[model samples]
Target: MYYIAHRLFAAHDRALAAQLAHHLALKVGEHQVFLPFCDTDEEDLVADIKGRRLFELDRERLRSIRALIAILHGPSPDDGVCMEIGYAAALGAPVILLTTDFQDYSSAPAGPRTVFPDPLLDALATRIVRVPRLGAPAQQPGTSRFANFAARNHAQVQNATEACVEAALQLPLPLPTISVPIRDGSTVYAEPSSYTAPNYALPGRTTIAGVTVLGPTRFEAAEPIPAARHDWAAALSSTRIVVDGSGPETPPGAALLIGAACATGRPVAAYLPRSTYTHATGREPNHRNLMVQYGLEATLRSADEVTAWISG
Candidate 1:
């Protein structure tokens, strides 16, 4: 049986610790939770109260424990739970550090911060290689205190779920627009508004130094290349930046483009739309070709929007 030693006892209040342990116990079957009582243990005659000083638990005995769930409460030297968590981490035991605050911790590298019972249980199930199970605790609805607690925890879980779903959705639809480079003294014709076409004219005599210049814009005559570039960069500065995979370095020179947009005061919105690019294309060349063309069209339309925003 897998054990989840309650390294949270020292950090949480007695009531809160008891609540957490009860909830955790419900999630994981046949688990052990250690609660150290220095004064009480000394006064009482409980031989099972294991600790280095209390029951003289050594490294070998501690190694026998399976996992450690560290609860990061406020700074307190009496927090024996934190120390136990550190020891467990040093022993290479699976450690899940729980914290409500975002304060910096020099002792242990931060892990996921979770509050909802479902998420906390899910984390444990993932680490301990246990079967997944999520169920709300049974309670009488007439009680105000229980209802209030459930309402708060339910909202927290819902918010976490929404955030996860949003992140998953953002992975495929990156950028959603691209700027068309228009330089000084360049004749630009706007493209007719179509389902998959940009509003800006294609590249004529101007180019934005390093980036690829897409053709066929249906917008106003082009301005100076540097000025257009700066304007486009300015618009992207505040947009959120999303990357598909940081493992494989971003496409060559792509980093520079993103970096330039981010260097400005605004947040650059960038995502690896390539993931969904292939999805947009089907087995037939007609649809695949159309998708590719539409991507270019969207890029042009984006440029028009940015230019308009910049000019505005």
Candidate 2:
């Protein structure tokens, strides 16, 4: 399966993204295409999604994906797409960065056809394919932005779309196997104490239900930044499972780590006690968001369940 990550917030972007994804689907198998904007097609920002299920749905779909076809554009490329690329790269999957925008970007030594400014983000690309932007931008407003461009440059759009599909078809699927031993006796790695979780104790336990948990330091430097992303890279590879054992609540970092784990096609499980999640009036809801809910292989509520999940 090929996961298509593109800008999804605006109508202009949405149209272009849909058109490109549609063409890619025609070239590849229809079942292979997964786009996050499917529910947002009518541009209903308010009424469409509930409880952030969209994020969970997309992340879940991204799991076990054969490769990534990420579209980069705008002054600042979509942060979500960049993360998607990084996740796919971590899994050692072939990433084809596709761009059809007319923006004049600098050819940095960092990445091929560099679209984004950050060197770290650019380094994730396995290859780059730039579609020649043929028509000029539409000056008028009211659906003319992407619609006019599409209408004026029909040939350009078709060719570019096919070019992207061809690039994707050349790559192998069911990505290569990689083996890394679990560090220590850990069956799962929990969120580190580096980032503060407002509602719960961070790295809640060293072990759950007799299964050893890895809580290695996420920072390599004196500061709290993920300076040691290498540690996570190794930890993720070493462990068979990555877990969000934050009990009552989840930290942002846990969400990020687990999503990365899912992106690598690793099975993950979590134990978020239901009692702690039900909030009183005026208090923030403590339930697990759908992102974690969807990413987890098992949603365990007790220590007893942890061992059983791990054994599987």
Candidate 3:
């Protein structure tokens, strides 16, 4: 079965997602495609403990999906979608990225700076399919828009969905083997921009709490970050907490860190602005993505807090 991974927050986004799923079903036959928002219980997503139930539900659903039809839109694609893509790629499932929105609001790569979709995300997907800009078809006038106007017309949407379906049909799944690049671990893994700026620093131990961090290759200075770069997969194994000080005001890059971290059983700790998100858990990280909001262990408020987290 094919899975449609998308954002379901905004009214237009919801409409667009529903529109995509509808179009996809027309081409591939009914009851074959699964859209998360359409299939899952949203009420249960909230009532469950910290949304762990939804997390588990989605993980299991992706495990069985044949291909991932990921909708890439907005300044950045949905973080949940990114996590979905990462999981699908790990399972060796084909990921067909379909986008009607083509604009890069993000910056060039510098430190953890994210681009249109972070290079890391670009690396994971099997292939990308770009559709013509979406807008109401010429015959249709003033389509009711709840949030933002629909960018692509009906015909373009049809074409994009068709292309995605064809691509999914052609790609091979469950490849015999997949290659993943690995980087040696470091005790502390912070962006090059972060180290010089003084967000958090280890007190003295190259090894924290007996975990040979990121693994064995210890870095305590500005120079190491550049060498290590942002290979989150390789780094997460060795690093305890990835300290990202870039809050929403700056639009964090490559969010793959969160995806890769979760995929590999690592905890990502970041300093977030209070303006982002606040929850019943007073110490929860200020994040927009429910996955990040709940999966995150804590928000680092000070160097002492960082040290305390790393040590424990």
Model 3, 190-286: lDDT tens digits are 4322213434454334566664444212133223323224444455435444545354422222244555555555666755524365344422333
lDDT tens readout by residue for model 2, 12-103: 66676678778878877678787776742323344333435455556566656888888776545554565566566666667787776666
**Residue runs of model 2 more than 4 Å from their true location after superposition:** 39-49, 101-115, 135-156, 179-312
- Off-target runs (Cα >4 Å) in candidate 1 are 1-12, 31-43, 46-61, 75-79, 102-312
**Cα error, candidate 3, residue 285 (Å):** 12
TM-score, candidate 2, is: 0.51
lDDT computed for candidate 1: 0.31
User: Tens digit of lDDT per residue, candidate 1, span 21-95?
Assistant: 455545444244443332224234334322213423322334455555444333331123423433343334455
Clashing pairs in 2: none
After TM-score superposition, the amount by which residue 272's alpha carbon in candidate 3 deviates from its true location, in angstroms, is 2.6
Most accurate candidate by TM-score: 3
- Order the numbered candidates by TM-score, best leading: 3, 2, 1
Name the regions of candidate 3 deviating beyond 4 angstroms: 26-32, 43-50, 104-117, 132-152, 174-176, 179-188, 191-233, 236-246, 249-254, 273-275, 278-287
Q: Name the better of 2 and 3 by TM-score.
A: 3
- Local distance difference test values of all predictions, in order: 0.31, 0.57, 0.57
